[model samples]
Structures are given as structure tokens and as C-alpha cells.
Target chain A: MTRKRFVTLTLIPAIGLLATLALVSIAGAIWFSVMNRTLRSADYEFVGLHNFLRLLRDRRFFNALENSIIWEAITVIGTLTLAVLLAVLIFETVKKPLWRNLICFAFLVPVLLPRVAAAFIWRFLYSPSLGVINYLCGLVGIGPVEFLANPSLALISVAVVDIWQWGLFFTVILLKLLETLPREPIEAAKLDSARTWEIHAYVTLPMLKGPLISLTLVKAVESLRSFDLIFVMTGGGPGTATETLDLYAYQMGINMGGRISYASAMSVLLLIVTTMAFVIIWKAGKKWTN
Target chain B: MANITCKNIVKSYGAHPVIEGLNLEISDREFVVFLGPSGCGKSTMLRMIAGLEEVSAGHIAIGGTDVTDLPPGERGVAMVFQSYALYPHMTVADNITFGLRRQGNSRAEIAPRLKQVADLLGLTPFLERRPKNLSGGQQQRVAMARAMIKTPKVFLFDEPLSNLDAKLREKLRTEIRKIHMQLKTTTIFVTHDQLEAMTIADRIVLMRDGQIEQMGTPDEIFERPRSRFVADFIGTPAMNFVRAEIRAGDELCASGGGLTLTLSPHSFPDLVAGQKVELGLRPARMELCGQNSHNAIHGTVVLVENMGAEGQVITNVAGAEVSFVTKDFRSLSPGDPVTFSIAPDHIHVFDPETGRSLRKD
Candidate 1:
């Protein structure tokens, strides 16, 4: 068989299937964004650009957008710092395979827990009346701090659950990357008279930069559109203190307001942000790998 | 340049000892090769000398300064790893001068040294490239340049050429020898390839199981291997081994494998009557003789491997398969009758109980 025919015969179906699946989802989102479909009724009307036009004056939408940016910035930064520290600490200190694996598996428990289950677990842990966290704060003579109640602390409190789950997730991935990295360069650096911090700064961190950036971008996108944990924990709670774009959009479309087309416009904006993130990831990966 | 001396070095991991009672001294600007098979602890010794591995017991001195407790960097030694552990993100020039940078040399001071080593290794054009973009040989040259840029007092190489193809390995082996000559730094190279050790080392130290078996010039190692392991390991196609007994009658004779040879009593004074001994014969010393030749072993040819100029003929003599290289094997085939003769001076006799050569040099 000719090379082109052989390749086409083997590859066309998979590519076509993937393309169709992606097109259907994107087309569905675009179609829904312009239609006034609601959970209250099966009937819908085509309202071209009306949902997007309403968004220009929506204060709640702007609040959700700003909250999303803040939440993503906090979640991505917090998770990365904790994950890298955890990965490096366990990888460097725990020499015994059994102990290292146990530590890694323990940290990975949050990732394996269902998002709703984790949210509920943290909800109890954050309870002002009976929470272990407030109880600990009480031991330090501080009164019960309303973790998910105060307007200022609600977003950060809900975002902590994500940082917990995804921090360990990224930690496990970074640990594997650390393990797979060739160790000779570090040893060579030692023989080259590099001091401890200098070796880490010059050799080790530079080696880890590509994978670290990729993980950060991935975590950024994940936190930007995060919903289930916040929805379960605070339900965008305590006067919209933690109502990020994803949770607010979900509430508007399906649950409380039943404004499906307006929510779809917000979802389309999120999709645009995520798509831009993916492009940046792809381009960064290409640049670094080369 | 520094002369290195390792005195009664012992290295162990937990209860398992890898190197035991190892002692050696390398003179200033000498090129020495630690030649051994896998698990022989040749690399362990090299690492100990480099201060990468700590010795459980011993004193290692560099230029008469005790460096046993010193770190690798403070020992003033530079090593080229077998993996060519060049930084993937750094350009070749940056990688080469990293040591100088770490040593707190200013950028102006490092620039000329980097350029010199790059030119020396023919890596001038590749100085801007990352290691992954370069070929294997080029990467190794960059590794060499990295070590050379340090201008270290003692140089260490741990099987640096084993990662390359045959042609590249050969080319680098010559290049390494040339660099050693030009720089005149004390050098210790570890390798399992006997040919590589033979070609590049000023002195070859053959090791086995964490102990030095024999050490000498390459010619001495090839000509007068003190042990059967050394003989069997050093040559291509390996030396042929056979069991024999000393017949101390009117004239001392060694008899084995349906062949008997007269031995000079002065050479093997330790031989006694009815004593079993192991005999070693180099492939190049044996040749095919006429069918009715006197004092020859009669054997059937088993297989002939033809290599253009010389062929190796495996012969079965008294149920033992002996292989010897011969240029006259072109007409020979398996199952053919053959007679073989050995040069007397080249015969090697070892104590069967000790595996040590009985013949005195």
C-alpha cells in the first residue's frame, strides 16, 4: 500500500472522531449562548447577542469575574508553593522507599477524595461552632474565626480546599519529575564547587523550570474555572463573598435565577480564557522542550 | 598537578563491603586506568579518590594533603561522567565554565578559559547549542571541555567512552590520551574494556571483586599477567585455559589435554611432581602444523570464524575446545583433522589451586 493511503486508513477515524466531539461541544456552547433557554420551560427563543449585551451592565457578573481572578491567583500560587516544597522535601529527606511511598500516598489522599466529599469534610472542619480548626485557634486563645462566613475570608477559605486537593496532585507529579530527572548533573554541580543554595538556584531549579511552568499554568486554568468544591462548601456563600464565575454561572443558569443564555455567555467568556491558557501552555511547552 | 595516594581504603555499604584494603599511589601527571569487569569496585575506588564516596577506613592524600574528609570540590578534582551530565538548559559555553563561575571567577576571567577548552575539544562552533541538540560524541566533547576548563589538579573519568559507538569511542580515546599529554594532569580512568585500557593508559591496574589483581604498564599486563583472570580478560577471543600436571622426572614436563611440553625448571621452580596446574595460551601464539608433526596436539576443527586477514579456529582436543587465531584457517572447516603447536616462551602455567601464574617473569 502507498504510505499516504496506509496512514489515512489507520489515522483518519480517530482524528475525525476527536474533531467531531470537540466541534459538537463548542457548537453547543455557542448555540446556547445566543438562545433564551431556561430550566423553567422547555420552549426557547433565539435572542441574538442579547445575553452578551446584558453582561455589559451586570455588576454581579463583574463581581464574579474579579473574584475568579483573585481566586485563581491565590489558588495557583498557594498550591504551587506548597506542592513544590512538599515534593522537594519528601524527595530529598525520605531515603527509605517504604517511608517515601507512604508519605507520597498520604499526601495523594486529598486528590483521590471526591470533590463533594472533600468539600463537605472541609465544611465541617471550618464550622465555627464545632470545627477542629476553630478549636485549634481556641487553644491559642483566639475566638472562633468565621472561615467561610466573613466576607473577606470566605473566598480564600473555600479556595483552600482546592489548594489542598490539587497541591498534593501537583506534588505527586513533580515528585515523579524529580525522580526521573538525571541525577548526575547535581553531582557534577557538587564537584564543580557549587554551594548548596547555588546548586539549587543554578542547576536544580533551572532543570525543573519547564515542568514547573507547565504545572503552574495547568493549575491556573483549573482554579480559574473551579466550581464543585465551592458550590458544595459555601454555595458561593455568605453574600456572594466567594461566588466565582463558574459557581455564579451555574447558579444563574440552572439553580436559583434560571437565566441559561446569560450564564452561557459567561461560560463562553471562561471558555475563551481557558483556550488562551491552553495556547500559552502549548507554546511554552514547545519553546521549553526545544 | 597533584599526585594521589590511597592508603588501605575500605568502603562498605551497611554490612556489605565493596572495597577492602585497597592501596595505591599515582605519581604526578600520570595517566592510570582502573580496568575491571562489572562489580569489581574500580569505579568505587575512583569515586573514593574523587571524594564523591567516603571510605570507611583510610587516608587519601592529594599532593601530600589529606583529602579523605574533604568534599569533591575541595579536593580539586574534576570528573567526566559516563552519562555526559551536561546541563540541558545551558549552552555549551555556559556548561563548560560553570565550574569557574562556581569558583567565583569573574566572567572576564572565565571567557578566555572557556574559549580555549572549546577550541581544544573542537566544540567552538557548538558552544551556543544545548546538549540535547548535539550528537553523542559532541556532547562527550563538551563534557571533556567542562572538566578541562576547571584546570583541575587531578582528573577523573568514569567510563566516559562506554556511552559512545565504537568509532567515536576510539576517536575520543586518542583525544583523551592527547589531552593528558598536553595538560600533564594526574589522571585516573575507570573502564571495563581491556582494549580501551590497553590503548590509553600509561599504567593499567587490573581489579577484581574490589581488589587489585595486577597493575603494570600495558605491555607488562599483556605479556606477564599474574593471574588467570587477567590473562582471560585482557585479550580478544580470550586466552585458552587447560588443566595439566607437572611430571617432575628426568626432565620436567607438563602434560595435559593429550599434549605434553617440556618446561624449564628454572622458570617454574614451584612446580612439583603430580601437581595439577592450569595452563594459559594466547590465541596468536598457537598455529596449525602438519598432521604428522612431532610434539603436537591432534584435534578436530570445531568452527572457524573468518575475519578477513586472520581467522579464529576452535579445535576440540581431548574433549576440550581450544580456540586459536590463524591466518592459515581459510581452507579449514569443522570436523577436519588438525595438528597444533605452541611457542614454548608464550606458554603460561598457573597454580590450579590459586589461579596464580606459576611461571616467573
Candidate 2:
């Protein structure tokens, strides 16, 4: 066979297959959202904007949207902040390489565990009666406080669990980036009389802006679509306090009341929100880098 | 505007000692260049002085105060790194004024100092631009501007021009000299380039194996090196070494590689008969001579290098390669027999065991 024919047959088919899969997934969601469809009945009708309009007015949908936004915001900020602090404290300050590696490895235990396993472990720790956290709190004279059972604390408890599981992800990535930073600028800062905190603030963090933004965008999107931990831990407990957009869509579409069309609409809206978030971060990253 | 002093400074890492028992003193406004090859501890000495490296033992003082234990910011010295270490995210103005801002200088005070430094380094136009937007030379200038704005007691430069091209290195070398003259700050510059040390330093401190081999003015170090290492290290194309045995008779004669030459009576006062020594001869000092000329050595030309204004002739003289520079290259070619002569005063004798020069004067 000629080179041109081989290239056309091989490359085009692979690319066409990927493009077709992506296009179908997106087009199928939009099509099902616009039609009155159900899993139980074969008969259906085109209902323009019915599911979206109801979604806009539904208080439970609004509550889930707010919870998702808060969850994403807290997870991204908390994880990044904790990751940077821990990486700098453990990796940069520790002089012995063996000790540094040991500490870093210990901190990465959560990441090594499966997400569902991590959720189970955190659920046990957050147990109000027999958990270590409440036991320690009891010793400190504070009464046993409900972590995942209280309406006010359920969302935060789930967010904390997400932060614990993923903060190490940022720590490993940012630590590698920190190690690759040119030492001369840091030494230059030292000679210029910059204090430790000031050096990190003015020189180190600014240099890390590109990687930090990219990581934040990635983690933000990941947190937005997160389901396994919240499913295992809270399961939208305490009257929908921890019910995020992902969980809410799963419940509406696949669980007891299978409003498949309405679930498809919610998923489409979530996709739009995540895409918009990614675009904003990407644009901000480009602007800062340039 | 202050003197700097290092007393018995030693730096070591783990079980390996890098700099050993070093001491140096620089008077006010004196420019000293520490010259050595890579890994010779010149940079380590400079970093120690800047308070960036902790002294393994001993004390350092800037001006009159001992600053050995002080943090780098409180030591009152500024350093320009070899990489030019300009903050990539900051504007030129911000990079220059970062230290001043940290010192709590208000905008009113920082503005003029920033402008003055920018003007001195010709960085006024690029004040608002980031370091990446500038050329290599411009980035170097920004590094200089950053260091100069502090106006500390001393300036430390760690091979600041090593990263630049030859032409820019030469230009910046002269600019640095001018800045030193204007500021009159006790400056310590470290470099391996002999030309840079010779051209810019008031005194050159040549180091080897973590200890100072020689410290003197450029002309003194060039003309009268204290040891074989100093002679070998300071000259371009390097000085030649020929193993010779001293023969004492009515006239003292040194012979090596089938060539013999008479030495001056006072060349080595402590010399004894049958002592083995090494003779050092600079390439530029040897001259092509006729076969019957006094102190002439015969050799066959192996290679001829034409260096525009002058040519270097590398010749095989009695199984030893001897190179000399000469302006008259018209009659030279490979395989041609040549004779060269060196004056008695130009010859340097070193003890073969210790590599120390035997000359008393």
C-alpha cells in the first residue's frame, strides 16, 4: 500500500472514532435533556425547556448548587494552602534527605488509599460515639459534636475529607515544581535581605503562579465532579446538606425517582459550569504567564 | 565604603573540607578579585563573606563589626550572582527596589535611588519591563542595578560576567570597574578568567585547593609569581615547565632535555649542587634567535598559530614541547628548525618536590 493510503486509513479512522465518541456523548445529553424522556416508559414527547425551567425554580436544586459551589471553593483553597504550607515545611526545611522523603511519604498515605477506602476511614474517624476524634475532644472537655450528622457541619466535614484525600496530590506536584525553581533567584533574595516569609511571598509564589493556577483548575474540576467520598460518607445526609450537583444528578436520574431527562439537564448544566470555570482559569493563566 | 576582613575562615561539608583556614583583609574602597579555576573555593569564600554560607570556623567582619553570625540581610553587603538572578516576575524597577522596600523605605526615598541606579545601568527605558523581556546584557545590568541600589558596605560578585558572551563580558567588565571607582565600595569579585582579574582588580588573590596561592598586584603576580602553581595558572597559553638539574661548578648551569643554560649568580642563593629543579618560562618572553646566540635552544617547529597581531610557535625541543609568541611569523612553518633564547632574568626556578619557587628576590 502507498504511504498516503496507509496514513489516511490509519490516522483518520482513529481520530474520527475519538471525535465521534465525544460528539455523541455531548449530543446525546443535549437531545435527552430537551425531550420528555423516562427510563420506565417508551412513549415520550419533546418538552422544550421544561426540565431547565423547573430546575431554575426548584429550591432543592438551588440548595445543591450552592452546596457544590461552596464545596469546590473550600476544597480548592484549603487543599492548595495546606499543600503549599506542608510542602515548604516538610520538603524545604528538612535538611536530611531520608527524613524529608519519609515525611513526604507519610503525608501521601491518604493519596495511596483508594478513594472509597479513604471515605470509609474518615467516616469512622468522624463517628460521634466511637471515633478517635470525638474521644480526643472528650478528653479536652468539649462534648461529642456531630460532624456528618449536623446540617451546618455535614458539608464542611465532607469538604474536609476531600481536602485530606487530594491535598497530597497538590503537595507532590508543587514540591517537584518548587525543587525545579532556579536557586539563584532565591539566593539573590536572601542577599537582598528578604525574610523567609517575604522571600516565599514575593519571589517563590509568584514564580509558582503558572503551576498553581493549573493545579487549581484541575483540582477544582475534579472536586466539582467528586462523588465517591460523599456517597460513602454522607449520602446526602442531614436533609441534603452534603448533596452536591453530582450526587443530586445521580439521585434524580438513576436512583429512586428516575427523572432521566431532568438528570440529563442537570448534568448538562454542570458540564457548562465546569467548562466555564476551566476557561476562566485557562485565560487567567495565559494572562499571568504572558 | 568599609573594609572587609576574614579571620581563619574554614568551610566544610560533611566529611569533605572545601576551604581551609583562610584569612584575608581588604581596606576601604579596595577592589579585590579572587581568581581560581572551577571548584577552587573562590565562590565559597565570596559566599561566606556575603553571609550566605556559614563559616565552619573563624570570624568575618565588614567595616568594624564582626558579622559571622549575622543573617545575610543584616550583614550590610550585596551580591550579584553569576546567573544574574533577576526576578522573572517583577519589573526592572521592582527588582531593583525590592531590598529597599523590605527595609521599610517609603516611596519618596526609594524613587530617586531607583532612578539613579536605573540611569547608571542604562535601564531607565526597561523599568516597567520584566526580566524575560530584556536581553542577556540587559538582564545583567538589572542584576547590577539591584545590587547597587542597596549601597552596602561591600559588593560581592560571583563570576557575574561568566554567563555573558565575550563582547558583553568585556563591556560589562569595564562598566563594573567604573562603578567600583564611582562607589568606592570594598568589592570582592570572583572569577577564573585571568584577563578579568588583571584588568579590574586593585589586587588579585589567586587561590588553589582552598588556600591562597598568591596575593599581589596584577603586574607583581605576573612578573614575580611566588610558586610554580601561580606561574602556571596566571598566564594565557600557560607558562612552560622544563625539568632541569642544577650543576654547580665555577659557573652555575641548569640543563634539561639536552639543552643547557647558565643562570644568574644571584638567581637562587640557597641552591646546592646536584639539586633537581623545574624552570618556568613565559611564552611571550622567549624570542626566536640565531643558532649561535647566547642562551639559545634548538628545536623543530611542530605547529604555528597565527593570532592576527602575533603568532605562537610550538616547537619540539629535545622531546619537550616549548611554545613562544613572536610577531614575525612570515618565516615560520611546521618542520622548520628554530632556535630560541631566554634572558637569565626571565627564568624562574622551582623546587621539584614542593613546587615552590627558589628565587629569593
User: For this target, which candidate reaches the highest DockQ against the unseen true structure?
Assistant: 2
lDDT of 1 by residue, A55-130 (tens): 8789988898889889988999999988878887777788798887887788889989988999999999999999
Question: Could you give candidate 2's per-residue lDDT for residues A67-182 as a string of tens digits?
Answer: 89899899999999989887776655877878867766777788889889988998899899988999999999986989999999998988898888789767877776888899
| Candidate 2: CAPRI quality band | high
Chain B alone vs. reference chain B, TM-score for every model: 0.97, 0.98
Clashing pairs in 1: none
lDDT over C-alpha atoms for residue A268 of model 2: 92
Question: Which residue pairs collide, candidate 2?
Answer: none
Q: Write model 1 residue lDDT over B142-211, tens digit each, in one string.
A: 9998998888899999999998999989999999999899999999999999999999999999999999
Compute the TM-score of each model's chain A versus the native chain A and list the values.
0.88, 0.93
Q: Tens digit of lDDT per residue, candidate 2, span B1-361?
A: 4898899998999889999999999999999999998999999999999888999999999889999999999988999999899899999899999999989899999999998988889999999998999999999999989989998888999999999999999999999999988888889999999999999999999999999999999999998899999999988778989999989798877998868887876867787779899999899988998889988989999999998889899999989999998998669999999999898888888988999989888
Which of the numbered candidates is closest to the native, going by highest TM-score?
2
